[model samples]
Target chain A: MTKENNKVTVSRRSVLKGAAATTGAALGAGALGGFPTIWAQNIKNVTLRQFGTGVSNLNDVATKVKEDLGFTLKMTALDSDSVAQRAATQPKSFDIADIEYWICKKVWGAGNLQAMDTSKIKNYDKIAGTFRSGKLTPESEIAQGTAPHTVGFVEGPGSKKFADNESGWMTLIPTIYNADTLGIRPDLIKRPITSWTELLNPEFKGKASILDIPSIGIMDAAMVVEAMGEITYGDKGNMTKEEIDKTIAIFIEAKKAGQFRAFWKTFDESINLMASGEVVIQSMWSPAITAVRSKGIPCVYQPLKEGYRSWGGGLGLSANLSGLELEAAYEYINWYLSGWVGGYLMRQGYYSAVPETSKKFMTEDEWGYWFEGKAAKGEIKTPTGKVLEKAGAVRDGGSFYERMGAVACWNSVMDENKHMVRKWNELIAA
Target chain B: MNNTISPEKTSWMLVSPLAFILGLFLVLPILIIIMVSFWDYNEYNFFPAFISENYDYLLTSKVTLDTYLKTFKFMILVWFFCTFIGFTVAYFLAFHVRTLPMQIALFLLCTIPFWTSNIIRMISWIPFLGRNGIANSTLISAGIIDQPLEWLLFSDFAVVLAFVHLFSLFMVVPVFNTMMRIDKSLIEAARDAGASGFQILTNVIIPLSKPGIMIGSIFVVTLVMGDFITVRFMSGGQSTSVGRVISNEIGLLQYPAAAASAVVLLITVLIMITIMMRFVDIRKEL
Candidate 1:
């Protein structure tokens, strides 16, 4: 029996070896310019568990990941809170996590995530310089020391150079980002809307909606309040208790007067609300606006005069990860920052961190349509190449630099977050 | 003594696995929740503490009372509709249908909706009840109304409709199980005693189906009271239940506050169940 078992095991190992060799040969002749030498180290059979959201094209990216990286990349998609829950309680269960930068401080404080070694990530230097500094444009810079990406870099022992505060590490690697503005049905609203205050305008009463999530939703309210000349916040991202109260009071009044048609919490809900004409205008993600337009609804992602409320998402290594698994993780992160994934995400209405890398993978027409804000040179397709735009359609908000450069607050987790949540609930309940 | 000891030991051995499972999965989690409810939490994270501020805040807040009252309002409304519908359906299946095969087939037909996802089934109401949905368009085209009915969806009416649609099945199964076991002779005897059809139903059928009604009520009340998703989506975020408040708190990482709210909800549900148990001893019938 033992001799027969040994024989079977040997045969299976040989079969796997043959399969690996054939795959390697295929990769050598394929589009990726063959397997890089660094991957030749026997990192096979290592499974890097990724706890993340499919906010980007991770599903499409997963199929190519195993073949390209020579290791299994298993991804488990979770909502933000559930991701935090798993990261805090079972840090060892995953090798890496993809999370929003707004929530990074809390997650890092919980000791679930660790800073990535920038030197190890080959495309780290390729990340847009604007992210490193808080500048949207040369002249219009976000106040110094307020850049979202700088929040997680701790300068301490065992750190690298240029790491502010404590070391040579980063909280997370910027993956996909975008500036968000409201999506509205241009055909329904007879007049033009230029300010965020229009969300609560009595004329659009019973036809406007906002997001139901508190952390993000309150910022939209703050913008409206600020635009209305109700009150100006010192820093909209991190509001104090009084700021939250004053903002929420406006929302409650609006809610009481039936200014909102609905408060949506999910992507599809917002799309359905706009597409069904249940709401004429609402705070929406860009993809959701595109989704509505694809369904033959006349929805436009309106560029408000007050600028866009931007949010960013990125990948972080787990605190417990090290050795071969860690190396494999580093490889995976580099692979993400490499041209393919970045290009894929950019095509899906997100701005990739390494713009140059993404540009290498995009067709000139695709680049013109997406980044240059020009009319499409041809029918624009998504990452999988299903047509998303006709030849004449111009992208909203113009070029990447123009759209992202507009000064506005990012999604935040404030010190008064608890009070904000309470007040926000009252607004919803009202 | 030896004989008694041996049988007792055998019985304990038989029950030990289940007891262990209940202790580990059920009892331990509740104990942890109760323990955590007294802890302290800030914006970033929660910490273990002996403070009762979480409970204090929950008990004193006006929002807590409003949420509980709203949840109870929904619970009572859904319970009324589900019980009325469930009992009537169960009655028809048990009494009106004479053949067993026909009864089984009809019962199976009632359960066909369960084969699909609950979330899908719940959201399907959107197209059916939306402003541009089938119901409104049909009404307009037929000249029944000038404008589409706004209250058909994303209203209190929609929330109740969704709860009834999702949880009516929970009401049906238990009531049907209890009804199937009710003796037919009781109804026949009541009729023979010169009782009218309504009289027979009241005097014999309903009395014997007490356990079923009680059981179904427990299922329905608990399901509606504990539900947050259906109310959230169906009401278009205008409504808040006790459970929704707990979820919102948990979303904000206010674990202590959430745990405290959950404990209150649990205690409230237990009290309701205890009162319901007085109506009929469900365990005896089962």
Candidate 2:
């Protein structure tokens, strides 16, 4: 039972004794919020918990609406999982949450959120039903407990699209989306490493990086394993144990060969690894490419012959609520899906479902660089003063967010995540 | 029974808060975690039932023990280094830094890190040793190194560096207090009785400072024993620490396995504390 010094105690959750010092501090501060007793008399408070891309902009818009639109909007910010976890536990923690779309079905299964009433927000109707699509078709035998409709969009690996028809081709709304590309340094190899095969190249030893998160990373590993015919994982969104083992073997073999420079836990680290040439190419997201391009480095997002993996994040509401709070929540959710918030996230190195609103905010040339995939029309330098003439995704299905409508991976649950993660660990530790 | 002298009944009220906290926060959850470790893991990261397989895999696997051994070895190395350095710094502050104001300032400086969140302090270390960090810039500017050191920020060395930085204060407070309370006249008497300054320090000061040294050691050992964040952050998730293992388990919602690791760590720390109490009462020593 004895273990090493670096063991993590139960500190993250219940291990936090002393009554959660941070929670206490927040409560203490909330006490002094100059909390208008008079204001409390007139206005009701609503909280919306969300994470990452949409947090700040959504908060700002919420504040604007509170001031001008006259709704006392109370918002709490948290990670993607926390949003779902809280809704599962204390149903009254928030009225709305910008949850990751894939998690929505999971939460709905746990009896967390109520079905989104479309009558509250007519805007939900005017927009494409693609945002409201679910993975199970209208006729699928997903126990009656599941939420039959999709609430909004989050970006992920691209797939097919269907109209009004509810099927596996359905997608949630376009949240902030981007492609997971192999960001490679041109100086490393004469020939571009555009395929998964390049990672197994003996020529470039100890010059790779991979994500440490097993969920997404294992999928990438399985993709490579299948491409190499070493493993075939993801059985209709469920990976068998054998398939997982094969993927693990491939990753383990790669590790033993000293193929990786290091592994990155965060988006920032991957960018730093790429920029310094420590890792020539690793599993990287669009933000990292945007960062490297800013540095005047010649790092290119090599559109693989196979395909770049993609991901997205967006919002939902607590199921327990309906009435006016629900209406206010729907407003916030739609505003998030609407141009203002989505557009802001898009221009800041993210692609939006509401591309039109985001483009309206961007300069004509900026729009061309991101969505149109055109080179800089005029002499322009990236945020880091790097000349990005042939800068953006050179491949046709670029702008990882916009194209996610065809992405089958968005919010789709793998049948066997445990086996998938176990396989992932085997791959990394191998 | 003499109420004041009886061990169990005398201080039950004094110990109630801790007992309650442990029962509610630590012991009870640990029990649940033990139950969870034997359950199944889903893609959504849920624990379903008692599927002896998770424990079966855990018990039968050699990698688990290997990771455990590496964690203990890391704790030993980290505890030794931090305690040694901590004793030295605390010694200088107590005996040498005679001015009260300066001592107060130094004490405050040691605690400055505590004022900020732990995460900020850990993250700040990254920039100092990162690819574009000061160490790399200074070396490159001095024409000492051409390329940024890939291993500088997320290596074993980096893990140790971060641990020492975080834990040194735990060492300093007790050692400094122990040194301050020593009879000043004992050193004077030793010097008067034909003893040199070094001998006086060695004979009187060193022996007297044991209480502080032991107390400080307990703090450092326990803290380093349980912390995984510094190592996890510094090593870029390559290295295994008991904390990392437990954290990964928790992330996958494997509560019982994580709990098992935690229980192991807690028991080890409690044993160390008990051993230290024999040399001197930690309460009086502090």
Candidate 3:
């Protein structure tokens, strides 16, 4: 194994050296008119393989990258769990990893990714405060759980340890995030649903669902338990063994009562559960709500009085990346934040990290409807040009500021994650 | 050197390829799983450490026993339905169908659903079994029910329904094979001895069909015992199976725990198959 690894290292070093020599020659050749000759020649050969959850690892993004950036951008989409597993265990298989903040907490310890220099980011200052300081506004209190800013930075370029405050080096370049809430069928329920406690309300018994992914599911359960005045957790993100026990206990009791109609693990499952009217209310993502709406259902991403459980995803460069390949990765990250991808994702109900840049790529009316929470001036369309909402329809959970500012917690990986997982299995068994 | 090879040596040469393939693909992987089952794991990575904690926890946990019992319940229910349905269908095809072409055509008709993906076939049930689905609406319109039956989907009933739907074919093919190969002389002989139709079926046909029944039972038992997706998808993630437990642990990156659960499940399945093997000598029957 050691010999094979050494041989691979030697071959990789030689490849990097050869690429560096070509880059030097290209730099000496310099800019021709306004366009660089490097993009037409050397950079076209650079294929960066990226993998992430199905939400963001889009075919359109890869197409747009080929069109605009002049490189082969290969993308593979997996579920969140598989993404984490691949990022940690098979780091050499990918050049870039688009992963969530909570997943970052798990994958970062593997040291498969190199820390990114924030100075290289063109739109660093324009990025949202939620990713930089765990705040949407100046007065915003940082919510519990693995908020993006907490694991957003490393101490230095080569450091494996996460810094408490922002350092120059970042673990992931902030790309897209959203404040998530439960999706409910407003037409079916025929009543105003509010509060996390509604997830356990007996009226919706056998007509409610929750996500089955243990880490994120536990946070949703924590939100419900706290809302029901059952337990006051010190920090929902970093729960103690006792807190984990209590939270699982509450959900198990509910499960015994047949409170949940189902538990979904994928985006489609949530959409189907709502559209079929099999489930009246459940934990859901922003895009899933849009998907249900696209099917002409009256699905609402209902905001509760408690607040939203938020999560953020970003791009991380592999540790093996170097030479021209590394430069192309940085360019890709810059282009990602530069507006087009941001605009595309935002239209799908996700918030762009560099919101100001994203605003440039969207129409005033589109921007107003999606981010400003204003009623649609006309028929609102998705990035694909499919009509999302008719005129006078308002975005659910209101404006970006209002929704993100009310974030009560973020998806987390607790210290007692193993214990929590075991208890979660027991909940399923029950 | 001998002019001709010995029969024993020729048999070994022929079997070596199969033995080598099984050792590489099947035995090696199982050995690796057993090794990994003893290793230790944390939140992110599993390291190479000889620790029995994974097995220790799995053996002691109440959830493991409950999950096993639940999996067994599903296996038993699915097996019973698949065997009964498969036997009836095969019996029909073997005895009642006069023409060989008609039997083949009808048998092929049963396989039309398998052409599409398993996931697609499984998911298609959602529209038919959902709360406001066809089954519910049809029942309501007929004045047979007032409210939609919630148990039609995302329930234990749905899980068993899907299992029987997907796997009865596994049972059918083998039973049909064995039944078709049975001699007509035995049935005629029983009828000549003044045996009634039911008596001939019980005394002659069933006795001859034991090998086929055993083969079908084994197929249904193994398939249902190891299923996770059917239980997860059909039951709407409410039900737990042994396979689901292993998969859940794997999803969390807990390889050791998953491997430990897998080892236990494999041993349980092997023991069940062994007990089943005692009922009939499959090799001799074949």
Candidate 4:
């Protein structure tokens, strides 16, 4: 019996030694932990590459949504245009991506995303009907989202830049969307500046800034051209190839005029340019408008008789990202569109896709001020008790939350993307 | 007779550990990277099958070649400038300096850039090259220029400046070491024989320092060839480089194309190093 025990002990000791040897080798190798390099071979987990700005804050939002459930969301930030291109070519790179409504139709046609799975989302039933089946919203639906829609104007010397009536599928969901209006420092370029012609006024020479971005920026220029009525693109969102050429010509003229003090790439750069007082008037975005207001500077979104144009962005799912992960992705999307999170996004200066969840969170006085455009009804506090003001409240698309979903634009590739980027470069150079 | 080991056997045994390490770390991964580059990236941007698409694009595309040309040009320019400046400074320290401590201090000064991280050193250049930077401010205040120059921070010249600042030390260390080894009697004898100072410096000092120059050139060229961050940060996306192109492809999750581009770069750098070795023995010099 003692001999048998000794033999058994030797076998056990050998097993322990083998285990330790393998573990030690792995530790010494500095083996990559849980690296999904192997996942490239495996088809189970889909990869997602999202391209945009504000990764720091978006990472926080992604964490909150992922932690609320057990889904793992692998997000990589990129340029908005680059995201559209990847979605255009490698549809499988991302199972889910956030794109602007302006680029929706073409991207969808490119087979980048699989559209609405209403079944996967249960609480989606709670969303307003206007957002479903596309457009046709009641006047009451205007203030339904988490944040009230604020009017944004086209490229002003000091104004915010918004996607106006220029064609292409609306790639953005239009959360923080603004209309094409003129923004001016009441201290510099005083009021009664109601039309597109004023943007070309020589008095503001070298004191204006415009977005250097080609696609949407051209659209804003087209709107101004349309407001002028002599130069025409013949369509709002739908333009022919010839129409695109004419629009480029009009933009080239402006570029040669040296009317702009600078062409900006980032939102912060625009702010810095404006703050330098070098640019007293320029096309701007909602956040910039809010920033100017917060500093107690007098800035106003000029109302135009011609309807202001706008653009938006929305969330979509991947075809391969089905089952629990897909369901989770949709849940996160629904929660985002469900008003609460949308309101939080809006309180920070954006429009919400869902208005109901955001509405309940808003006080009656707060609602009146933002929707009615009267005065500060009260110190509007968020769920976290943060104070925010309701400015840029007079949004033109009362049904903007619902009506903008018909948004879709096809992205051009190969020779076409080259042409677009080139045209933009020439426009800046000119 | 069998009790004593053969010299050949002893040598093999001694070299086996080094052979094993090189094979495992360098040879194996390189082979894998090359193999993977030839594969197709699937729905998840994962390598799955033997694919020609990645290579087809990288090899044939205009954008790829443009980036390669830009990268090569930048490498050559940076190498030439860095080597020239480094040799001058190193020559002064080695020949002109009177004290050994002073020489050591100057050598340490050459290495001061290494004391901090490469990234921090590069980024510190931004404040000095920005729109309202010190140079511009000084120029403006001194009435040398009217407005702030927007081209300073993000330009090809700026990229070169950063590259030289970062890498000049590689050239300095090798050249300085080479300069120190020259016999004083040889120089005196050359002078006594009526050889001019410039001639002696060129014929004796330069020819003798060929090995050191080769070693330093290889180091600087190889490093600058692989660098993308300095170009990317300095150029602000105005131009493209090989490393930047690879980084962009990686960002888009196009790993196969990125890997293929890396393979191409690896081959180019290898060819360069091989050419350098043909002229002089780098191993002996180092």
What would the TM-scores of all predictions be?
A: 0.90, 0.75, 0.94, 0.62
Index of the highest-lDDT prediction: 3
By summed lDDT, the worst window of 10 consecutive residues in model 3 chain B runs over B200-209
- Reference-based lDDT, each prediction: 0.81, 0.60, 0.90, 0.59
Number of the candidate with higher lDDT, 1 or 3: 3
Ranking by DockQ: 3, 1, 2, 4
| Predicted candidate 1, C-alpha RMSD | 5.6
DockQ scores of all models, one per candidate? 0.58, 0.17, 0.71, 0.06
Residue runs of model 3 more than 4 Å from their true location after superposition: A1-39, B1-12
Query: How close to the true structure is residue B199 of candidate 2, measured as C-alpha lDDT?
Result: 94
Instruction: List model 1 lDDT by residue over B153-269, tens digit each.
Output: 888899999999998978888888888998878777888889999998888788778888888899899988888889898989888898888888877678888999999999999
Off by over 4 Å in 1: A1-41, A143-146, A157-167, B1-18, B283-286
Interface root-mean-square deviation for each candidate? 1.9, 3.7, 0.8, 7.0
Q: Lowest summed-lDDT stretch of 10 residues in model 3 chain A?
A: A31-40
In model 4, which regions exceed 4 Å deviation?
A: A1-123, A126-131, A136-340, A360-430, B1-25, B32-65, B191-197, B284-286
User: CAPRI verdict on model 3?
Assistant: medium
- lDDT (10s digit) by residue, model 2, range A267-328: 67788788866678778776577677777777776767655455555554555554334555
Q: A4-75, model 4: which lDDT tens digit per residue?
A: 534543453354345345545655787645223332222122223344444113665656555554333556
- TM-score of the candidate numbered 4? 0.62
- Winner on TM-score between 1 and 4 is 1
Which pairs of residues collide in candidate 1?
Answer: A154-A166, A154-A167, A155-A165, A155-A166, A155-A167, A156-A166, A156-A167, A159-A168, A160-A168
Residue A79 C-alpha lDDT in model 2: 37
Q: In terms of DockQ, which candidate is stronger, 1 or 4? A: 1
